[model samples]
Target: MSLPFKTLIKIERGNHLPMYVQIANELIKLIRGGKLTPGAFLPGTREMADLLAIHRKTIINAYEDLSVQGWIESLPRKGYRVVSDLPVIKPRSFQPKNNYPATSISPEELLHLPAFTRPGMVNDYQPGALIVDDGFPDINLTPYDFFLQQYRQQLNSGILYTLNFQKEEGGLLSLRTATSSFLNQTRGLNITHEQVAITRGAQMAIYLAAALLIKPGDRIIVSEPSYFMANQIFQQLGAVIHRVPVDEEGMDTNALEELLKTGTFKLIYVIPHHHHPTTVTMSTARRIQLLTLIKEYQLWAIEDDYDYDFHYRNSPILPLASADHDGRILYIGSYTKLLGPSFRIGYLVAGVQIIEQAIRYRRLMDIRGDFMMESALAALIDNGELSRHINRSKKIYAARLDKTTELLTSSNIPVSFHKPQGGMALWLRFDPQYPLANLLTNASANNLHLYGTAYFEGYNTNYNSLRFGFASLQEQQMEQAVSILAASLKKK
Candidate 1:
């Protein structure tokens, strides 16, 4: 289909940026400069290419690239058009558009798109929907009104107004001290505030830690079939990630030791306390071995303690940091699973020197994340509200995990998993014959959202596993969710 593009763009073929990218950038500049208004139609690729004496494919490539990266849109028979939701980067000084209030953008353009493995199923499950999915708390247990009251009190307080752009290391007075005290009591690690760098969440903390340590051509050791997102992050940073296979006792220290002797690794990321997708905790002896290997190989051990707060059985073991003789471990934790996602608070505790370096890198990536929430978190900690809330949340999570595991075991589903002492996820390994592609498709048909096992180093192995977050599901719904999941795989 042919359409008209009225805008003009000057592309420099010799620029360091690629030809297509240069074209995209010029369009971006026009949009930002307000020369290209929203809803304006653009020229067809072949026509524009003919006018500019470039290949039709080049123009098409530029348009496709921009659309993919969330700049423009293509409508059938209407050529490319400037995104209606685009925000103009108005001139700051004396320009009327500078005072132009911020306009809205759609969820399609923004990065915060929900976790939709399938393109069209995100809105399939919703609050108050009649379905067996993990969305809200069990209405029978906690009072909705009580939580509202506490939240309202926080809003009325002075915490919201004083979101100072404090030290890049994180909030100093309230939250920092609380994090130190909480870790000391819960994890048995005696880290000072200076050693702790609070973050928007554990994911960001991991990114900062990885960025601080990793660069192009550096080697990093990871568990085979490990957390796909973490692997993706490390991969994006250009580090060569070496995947070491795991067993029932968390990360394979012996395999790592052998790998270390043969190759140099800049970082080794592990979920030692209760691993993701595998649900295995590293034995203390293995922990010692890992620490020894860290010193022997001179590599940084990044321990992602994502769900240590919820241990159903005996007390949760102190994380690797509790046993670190040297300052090589950067223990990470977050409150997303426990209280709620809105907290957006996570912390990394390391030696004072490492914290300093991480903060410098953090500032560059994003300056002072969620200052108001951070300050409120500090207040919550100082007043012991945070501790109390976590303790209560832990019991609730423990019950959910127990019920879910019991149900899965009773069903005799062709799945077996080591019950993690702590953590919210249940890592289920299907029979060797089960293929992930089929399971995902069938599961979605039954209105279930299941992720693959690759995130926990399950890529190379034929093991079919999935991590289920029990902390978020209603206790009654876990049985149904599991049954649907099990049936989906069986049918496939």
Candidate 2:
């Protein structure tokens, strides 16, 4: 009897399982169900491939797997056939009862956790709409395929077993060592793998740094319009947040110095390069003065240089940690903005004592990062692949920023913005008379996505400004988006 190929075999492409594995498993089920009896011949690979609308290679691989498992045999001058003696396996007799156990914890009994408010940019996303992100990189420039190739090579070479199973909860030695060398060479920072704790991203680094440094009711200083996520982390740790004002030259060190003179603060958080939402680089004089204060007062600071690689106008100032001889700064950075957000590789550099404390806390939450990915990244860094990619991405992002500025200038919208010297976004301040909510709704209807005005909501006064990230948007898309924005303003 001939088998009905279409009715007997079905492959679900939407499933996480591979098509070939699904086919092989389905054939085993058919044999067990007595539909394919002992000594029955199977259909040809080509016929099955055509019937299923899949490639013949998939059928071949499935058949090979079945043959290896003794479910089928190949006869001379003939195709595959079901084996005479199918492996006898006892059927399961017990069924799991669906009743709830008395000891099981109910949802209502679970302890209440700390509450963190979701920001607008994190929640504002529409499918199939062109988005003006908040300082995100163009993911199209990421070399993921190359990284995948490196991963496969290491897996095949069987060298990842030892590389992954090391005792250090910090990170892979090779990656940390490579990162140390890279940071030292590029940013004028000196550090070793022992002083570096690899993290999933800058956010994780911030959380770890905050958790280790902050205690309940301890005062910590932050910029007024600081990175909101970092501020949230500090608040979650029960730290009293003292906000200072920022100017065109970056965080006002004068204000910080005055505060330190009369009062004591546990920690201060600063983003010196292309400050978030404002895109202002800190001046050299402020940096020197800030370092002097940190040393004199023995103050600890978290220096987050999230986008250190995309500078366009001139050479970026070295991080505060590079000049701190007294070890007062904990430097944090990530490759998410440089490579892609999906590549969650960030690092923290500090003194050995703090790194040891970070590692102890890190082990409780995460034993280690993805070693295979980290190893592959180290290989890329060693061979200069990451360097080349950064150089290429810098030029592309610079051009995109220039083009976006031109479009925004010509849009005739009631918005004023200064071209950012570095970083991926433009900070646009709308007239106080313009309605932000209406503008966002109208722009969404026009297929243009803009972040809601929730970023600067916690401030004393409502600052009518938004960071219009342009690195991810193409020239044509930028033009269309700005045009829609202008139309939305007119509609309002």
Against the true structure, what is every candidate's RMSD? 24.4, 19.6
Query: Local error of candidate 2 at 209, Å?
Result: 0.8
lDDT tens digits, residue span 98-200, model 2: 1111121111111123665422223545676778878788889887877878877888888777775678688888999999888876777667787788999
lDDT of 1 at 339: 60
Candidate 2 local Cα displacement, residue 319, angstroms: 0.8
Q: For model 2, where is the 10-residue window of minimal lDDT?
A: 101-110
Q: How accurate is candidate 1 locally (lDDT)?
A: 0.66
Q: Candidates' TM-scores?
A: 0.69, 0.74
Off by over 4 Å in 1: 1-121, 126-169, 451-459, 490-492
lDDT values for all models:
0.66, 0.77
What tens-digit string does per-residue lDDT give for candidate 1 at 131-228? 33222223343323444554566588754554453554554556777788877766777666877888878888887777767777889988875766
